[model samples]
Target chain A: MSMRRAEKQLARVTGLILLALVLGGCVNATVDEMTYNEPVAGIGESSVVILGRRHKPDYDTEFDFIECIGDHIHSGDPSIEVINEIAFINQFYPWFEPRTAPLQPQTIDQLLQLPPVAARFDEIKLEYMIWIDGNTENTESTGSMSCGIGPGVAGCFGFGTWGTESEYEATIWDFTDKVEVGRVSAQTSGQNYMPAVVVPIPIIAPVQGTACDSLGDQLLEYLSAHH
Target chain B: MLCFTLLAAGCSTKQVVVEGNFPKPLLDPLPITLGVIYPSAFAEHEFFDEAKGRAESDWLVKTGEAQVEFWDILFDGMFDEVVHIRDWETVQRRAAEIDGVLIPAIGDLQYTIPTHTNVKIYEIWMRYEFRLVDIAAIHQQEDGALSFNPDEHLAAWPITAYGKTPTAFLQTDEEAVNLAAVVALRDAGAHFVTSFGATPDIAVWLDGIARREQDAALSSSDDASGPQPIAQSSETSSSVEREPDSGGTL
Candidate 1:
């Protein structure tokens, strides 16, 4: 009986080890794998389509800025041509609702029908698409001390605390080949805001504006100079 | 037992992520000037006769008024940055003083009958082009073309709407084009400077110059990379001649 009990204990330990290994594999699989190809250089007339799933507050503001910049380009240069302006009417992603939505398949098909959309873009056109997901949820902790004792006495006891901050992830895909080219995941804490302010702050505000502005400026300049 | 094992295994997985950063180029502030290039023709359609008194009458009375108003608003917004040149001659004179030239060309302008209005109305469509000429290279580097069709309609009820007087329409078109020009110039100029500084070949050249200068500072060195030689040669070889401008007002 003693030997049997020892064997049973060993089996339980082995089973636990195997379970842990499998779970570890599962966790590792969740990490995203991003890759990019070499940059191509050439000069030719190209057309671009800016499509989005839905109009959110942030997106609307972004589009307004984009349109303003685009107007500048159009008014200034004759070689650069704008083909079409289209938008999708669907809310595909619920988790990041209002912030991001999935582009309707029909919209994509319709855009493909336009001659300018695919006329020059045989294999090399750059299709820019953005997907924003997740929300900021966080928790924190502190330490406390109390007096306790054995039997009839009390002794001092210290408490420890821990917490987590909410995080969100954004993925940008190049639809020319229907593959994700870049992904950025960021986390914001309550401490990021002003100490006295009660309002929650968005961590992406600075990044979004800065990245868009920089990229837009660069691309426009390149097109202007080259075209 | 299984749950405990799974949790333990999950904690052991380690992933190493790698990231790369682009090289940063040193930026030096240098004084730069830009010129303007104007297109010769102003008419959108070939059918319109320039000599005919009534050729532009209908357009000027209806869409032109709206355009003038648009230009006024645009100019008011950019009063601080842009220097308003009255005509092409002034633009050319100013262009000679600048390092580069931004020539805005009006590609198309039209007014279509409004479809939604209960009464007669018009929708103005304006398209313009911007071209940046690198004076030093004597080459056109960048061009951007865009159009705007403001959906707002002017009510036909007012007698001033059809007024043939220049006051009713001249400023509106000018304002819209000028506003568009200012934005285009600012964006294009910023882009050009950034790109020129960031180019790899240019960066290497600039770095070599910097390194040579640094060496000269530390040691008694003669002209190594020919520091002031290139600048002097270019300046002395070129004559500052103003080009003739013939484009009309926006």
Candidate 2:
């Protein structure tokens, strides 16, 4: 190979290394978990339903996540019946105004009094109910960068980074025992880099999806664990 | 900055809750049907910032709901019905039934600088006015309604308490205020309870003026023949319409 070609190759490799170094270290993800009650054998025969907290408006946007979690639970234990969200809304929630439809019982007494929710519990022979609520927020941001390949030499434009944090917690409620079974919490946060000259290059992490994945796995383990 | 004056410290508000520390047992079951009138405005202090000229923290409008709660909890068995006066018209109309009214006010307040550093201090002076007015004794206005005369029968008590948090206390300025207020209010409340009943000088006067009337026996009562029906056992709430202020008046 000619020395000119060799030098060009070396320059490209060094530029790539420099670009890698330019991106500062991203934050690591963290998680916390807690289990409240001892596991019992009867959950295997009982059906389950996942309900988003009523107060938060964003829970409506998490239908896909609910389905994803339901799929994972069903895959983990095929016999465990997972109620469909659409069916729940149509058949059960129709009894009350849109505002009053709540699957997660505030109190055992409230559950007994709510005819529609009680009837649905009887219909599905529900055992465990999972209440999910969480939020993803951009907590902090810093640094700006602009880089590009101008002619043969790489030039810079502007570079910057911002942090994104995802936090989710799922609580399992047992109807038979009239108690909270356990809780699974997951959180993921990292900073992503964006550089632009003519075009912008971004390295964004799937923070929300990653949290959902961790929570789903943890919920499976919590439900299936012996004690 | 000229804009940041000594009043600037009064801008911020820190919520402080003083837990009960009353060790005095009820001296006597007075059973006085008392109505609580929380203060309209306690003392307010404008605190200074780092510059000692900028007013960064100020005690603004505060609610006396907590005071009502404290009074009820502290003097639980002492009064027959510890009603919080919400509707002044209604409470005043039924005022004839109440034996006395308790009014609480914050008198004075002072704070030190640099809670994060050395030489931090907090102090509060609280005053309570307990008026045991006899409706029949007070004079009537031109409209024929009974006029409340403060001179009729009133007891005023002033209490001063201090909390000092040195640099070693390891608390923020806001935290120092909270901690200091907690200590001061708790001490003031406990002191009030003791002085209201336990003190011989005050108890003798209070006992002579106020006495709970026992329910007379119904002629057809199953146990009416007995000496008297136990008024203490009666769970019936007072017929007096009790209420609280609508907004944060105190």
Candidate 3:
């Protein structure tokens, strides 16, 4: 082949290789799919209501898991009345003591607008309320090294470490005769981090499902058997 | 040229390990009950306010509906769960159970009829307070506060600026209030949850950490790698272009 032709061929090959490399680097990350087990039986027929809220927008995954558990129970036992609505948790409800601030009529109106399911149920009655704590630890380490220019012929650099912990509480209430009959409380903790990195790539960890399922199951079973 | 090409290829191929660990909620089937209660005057307020005085009550109904929808979307989006109701009495009974029991309160209303214009801007401020009650410990825990300023949220709108019809302004304000409430709830929830415990479910814990790191990174520096970047990416990417560019060299 002529010298000019060979050079052109080499350039074409190099360009193709570069294009492929860049395309290969593209990645799309997503949360792993979760699996759930069937609800345990022997609890019998009962009615239930749950009010829960997550402080963070992304924490909906937790509620989804809880709902899945509720669905399982409803599927297994037809007589069990399960009314789970995040709205009832009253995200607007004040948490401070002395409770001086007047409840917003608008907020009350919003709650009232929800389906009147509570008024119809007679025998079994239950309510669950959840709150996510914010005092968690978080850490991250990132560094980069470039062999050419700027600093030196050969150079290296890196840093990253973060930790945070937050609290969450679930309050269960039983409504019988328009009164609270029972209340159960539970709490859990969580922590996570991203190790050191040289590039600006996204780092996501594999998350294993925790005890939320058991908590949901236990709450349902308790309501079913009791009420 | 060959050496440079080889080096570039190597750099691109080098895999930098990135790992993260956090908490996730467990999935367990359970039966639960839910209830929704509203003041008896809700319907009357809507009909009377709309039919008689300035028709502001229609706006109230719209605002109420929007608020409910907003909460439904917000919770559904965050928890991946749906609130199902078997009956409405459960909600009334629940509300009645706490009838005398004072809890963290929220709600206030103020209306101003402009002297010059025929428009009236009703400012609705919805606040939420959670009295962290530790049932297990049988003691009242810490309390958190969150407030929503709907006026500030809607101040920049064209309708509000130009003094549009009360109906139009009311619609705008209603939308604004709904959005503001969602934000307030999120903040209040975070504040309440954090005050009670330092740890959260594994998935939530990790997510919280990621958010904190992101916030720290953002506050410390304006670099794109900070926490704000993740938020922007997640929020803005919904409208991002997916098609690849195709063109000849200029």
Candidate 4:
């Protein structure tokens, strides 16, 4: 090929490669799904309330996970009642902190004896109450990330990968039985890669959704099978 | 390294509170069963950035749980009598359990640490918003009784504390932010103690009872020619009230 034609071919190839990298970098995804429950029947007409344990600096991503569970449950069984955390928790948000553990079975039992289902999540009959607790953390770290202008180099630079772990668990109870029923937990880990360059590109592995969905699906399956 | 350091430093959790022991309640320690609903915990507030002319969030964060604990402790120290923390929903569902409710919101939680070397001053401030609502009126409303039109039934106040420190340039700005919180909480608590009034219904109802007693005594004296009852001034009789419209703090 002539010099100009060869240069054009190289430009096309570079464009295709850059496009592929952009698309691949966009997917900083992680997931881990698990469940431990046998399905039962005669749970219809009863309601389920899903709650999450609250944390410092609550992220909007939390709602995404919760809504996903609610959505999946409805799709599985429209008749079954699913109360979102916000409607119940925010209604009394001052009192019922979100994502926190529910009152102990003893406390719940006493309150229910005096007045059935004192959680007051809703005025209806609730059989299943699910409490969720989880958070994300950096499991390990290596190398360093820095941004500076020295000699001929400028902008940002980093040459290392940082591992992040997302851990979560859900504890379920049958208030009707006034006993502990089941607990589901999930964890996912991945590394965020950063290559030294003029403009640093750090691939982040946001596992909040992954962990939430994995547990959500399992929780729904358990609820579905039991119902 | 500098940018990473800054980000790491910026991400933190802090509890803002009055440093020293809370002062004694001055006004006979009106010991009504007080409860706070959804009191702010340590977290970023968007308003802090709004005040600082920034659009980003997480710039100002607070440990709201600290505030909740501080309020619990401050009341324990300030009040000579019990100040119970009623379950938020129980109080809402059964309004009679609580004497009054304080829903608190916070602002200006972040410290302003200028990034540039030329800017030498760093400042921090916090604002507390208390929405004080009367329990009786809420009960009345819940009972389908005619509701008062924002009259003596509700009052809101904003309390703020400010602090300043020379640009640290290199040292952590946490010190300055914390100092500001201490000052803010102290000042805010004092203001709350002196200004927070009983629910409007209680104040108004009590005021009516006092006035009737005074009038009856005056009439009885006028008829029997009894020694004229000592003149009772309105300010001295009804000083417990802090209603804003009548030349009072709103």
Candidate 5:
């Protein structure tokens, strides 16, 4: 009876500890948007292409983050269509490559003057082109945990934490009108904790996911408003 | 024996072979039949980097197959007709029929990982040297037979390309290295297609070809058709100038 009572107490304590770990990590996020021009009317059938800017030497906008935003926009509104980034890039190979891609809205106009490019552009009927830039990075880390093994017993004991920050900007251009439509940006930061008694339990902060959510919400609203 | 095998496994060198597919470029093929010579050394390129520390492993990267594939796709898209030359003898025999011969070789290659650069990415850099042989000059020898000069080339230029992939997403170092190499190859192809005619020597050679073709047409035309103008397509007539800015922007 004494042994049974001890086992029950251990089970109750483990449940409470797991509950605390589940709710430990926290993140803070903010989103900002600006409109330079309204979306063109009667262009709902065309698709939008979201591309990540990779020209920066030190960092690149993660491809998964771009896909997350694209997915959010499509899921939020079933009518809106999103083209695969790789397909669109490959179809226009060298023209849209890092070295040759146009920098300004006017340069896009020059590209469309080519018959082959113009034909492909018309076939796709691209409504809007969104360029995403930025990255997520670990900002700070502190504390450490150590593990040891001896005589058939191994365990870790300590507390540790780390912080991550994500910043990103999305620029939207109206391909039909050949003009800038608007911009949306999101910034987020979070702290993650790992506390160990016997086994280390990690509570990972959703830093990138939060940023993607904020940016995607704003973009969806902006694109769907006119429709 | 098992202990010895484990020790050997721990010290085994890492090997990576690059492979990728490239799409055909969206542009009008230039109006010229070109001959391309791929040297044997270029077709089987391999780079070996020894580990500088005990913590790192040696690497042997082979990019020969990928190089050949990339060049084949790029040449097919850039020229009207591509004739592969097996050797200089083939070039000598066919020099009169071809507009020019282009020879490409790997100049140098280097790579870095996160462990070495303290950056969270894997990067590869490649230098390519291109030689454009003036077939017209070679075919116009005073003797009936063609003369060859190893030191003579109408244009020789170097192009540099770079590629990098973040280490965060890749699961293994070999995968990261392979990706970086493929990306570098694509960059080189894009640069060449965009800047081929913009090089100074190439521009002069193109002008000479246009003049020669125009003169030949004028001579062959009947008196009634008198001094026929060279028919140049809009795409062919436009001059592609090299961008002054380096690295990508916007």
Candidate 6:
């Protein structure tokens, strides 16, 4: 082959390799679900509430993840009504506050025995309450990038990578029966990359988003299933 | 020049004004007219902390508006009628018409940021001193039946509340701190409503009011049904001893 032809072939190979790397970043997610009681059928008129556990002093289940799960479940099944987290919590006020929220199904039953609390719950027609606990964190990280500017020229040249993990569990409770229905959990890990050659190109791994999607999908399946 | 400007901007004071809507608590109202006193210091409360290090920024957090709003809603929901008094003088002047008076003051306020804790979170803590004044006692003094003494007709207690917000989604430290403060204020309101009339001092004070009302009702009633005992408020009221107001310190 001629020199010009060889150069063109080498350029094509490099482009294909870069495209593959950009399209396929390192991401892994696992989802598990267990059911203790059968879900009630005909949930068209009932409502579900998704709440984040915030009692931990070190960390809290992020609100955005809860919202993501709500949105996903609603999208999956339009018949199921999802209540806004803030609005539902505010309607109940102190009973559902961080410090006073019921941590167990039995506690919820006792709270419901209160006339005022029971009246409000009846008004809302709540059926299912999902308590989400866990958070995304940077488990490990290595490498660093540096940028410098001198005289008339300025640019960045370095490479860095960081690992992130997200683990979340959704505990579903049957509000009408006051029993633990089931639980669905998702664990996800990913590595992010940054390569700087004059201009830094970041390849971000969607660790949290993947975890939310997996948990949401599993939760939707668990709720929709009867037996 | 640009670096100097950036440094100056970094050193500028961060002012956070807490703002949010506090919901009315769902509970049976205590059957009593309450006179609320919002001292100027409590109503216009602000916390200021100068940066201790070069990397830190000064914070001036104004929580007065939210404080007044939260307490107003809470008190209005908890009592049969809530009367906002401008000062203690007003409470003294109209002591006869009111059943009791409530005065809330900030004892202490503290906060933390992600840089300080290395935990990517912002937290705020508040201590509130609440004084429940017996209007009947004040009314007696006002009627010239007894000597006027400010400390003789009151019971005071302290409540501590805490709140925190994660910095993952927040774009700025000011926003995080503001959110944290709002959460803390809401927490304070929640604590007040759930624990009111349960604290040892406040419970005894409430029990005394209940007994007085019961006696008054029995004397004035021609029939058997005089108001029933407040279930939650008077449950443990008689069991606890009332603590004297020791210089208004809890």
Interface RMSD of each: 19.3, 23.5, 16.1, 14.1, 1.0, 1.2
Ranking by lDDT: 5, 6, 2, 4, 1, 3
Model 3 RMSD, rounded to 1 decimal = 28.1
Each model's total of backbone clashes: 40, 25, 81, 14, 0, 0
**Per-model TM against the reference:** 0.22, 0.38, 0.28, 0.43, 0.83, 0.84
Question: Which of the CAPRI classes, incorrect, acceptable, medium or high, describes model 5?
Answer: medium
Instruction: List the DockQ of the predictions in order.
Output: 0.02, 0.01, 0.01, 0.01, 0.59, 0.53
Worst 10 residues of 6 chain B by lDDT: B139-148
Q: How much is the TM-score of the A chain of model 1?
A: 0.30
Runs with alpha carbons beyond 4 Å of true place in candidate 5: A1-25, A40-42, A147-158, A197-199, B1-10, B87-93, B135-150, B223-250
Q: Mark the 10 consecutive residues where model 2 chain A has the least summed lDDT.
A: A93-102
lDDT of 2 by residue, A19-121 (tens): 6356534445566778766454536666787765433322222555677778777787676678876455434422221233344445655645655456656
Q: Cα deviation in Å at residue B43, candidate 2?
A: 56
**Which is superior by DockQ, 4 or 6?**
6
Give one digit per residue, the lDDT tens place, for model 2 in B1-250: 5346535535545444443322222234466767665544432222222333233443421325444554556555456666665454545465556655565555555555453233323433344444443322233344433234454344545555443332323565555555445444444554554456654544654664444332242332546556754342222122111221122232
TM-score of chain A of each: 0.30, 0.69, 0.38, 0.64, 0.84, 0.85
Better of 3 and 4 by lDDT: 4
Winner on DockQ (2 vs 6)? 6
Q: Which candidate number maximizes TM-score?
A: 6
Candidate 6 docking quality: incorrect, acceptable, medium or high: medium
Reference-based lDDT, residue B241, model 4? 33
TM-score for candidate 3, residues paired by index = 0.28
Poorest 10 consecutive residues of model 3 chain B by lDDT? B154-163
Per-prediction CA RMSD (Å): 27.9, 15.3, 28.1, 15.3, 8.3, 6.8
> Under CAPRI classification, how is model 2 graded?
incorrect
User: Per-residue lDDT tens digits of candidate 1, residues A1-227?
Assistant: 99998678557544544443343222101223233441244224554333322232111222333444345445555555533332221111111112222343224444445343344335434344444343222245443434543576644433322332333344545555565555544443322111111121111113233333333443344445443
Candidate fnat values, all: 0.00, 0.00, 0.00, 0.00, 0.67, 0.45
Give the better candidate number (5 or 6) by TM-score: 6
Per-residue lDDT of B1-250 in model 5, one digit per residue for the tens? Answer: 7668766755679899998888898888888888886766678888999888666788999998889889989899888999887644565566555777787888999999998989999999999998887543233233333333444577888988898988874368899999899889889988998788899999988888888787776677645466554333222223111112221110
1 versus 5: better TM-score goes to: 5
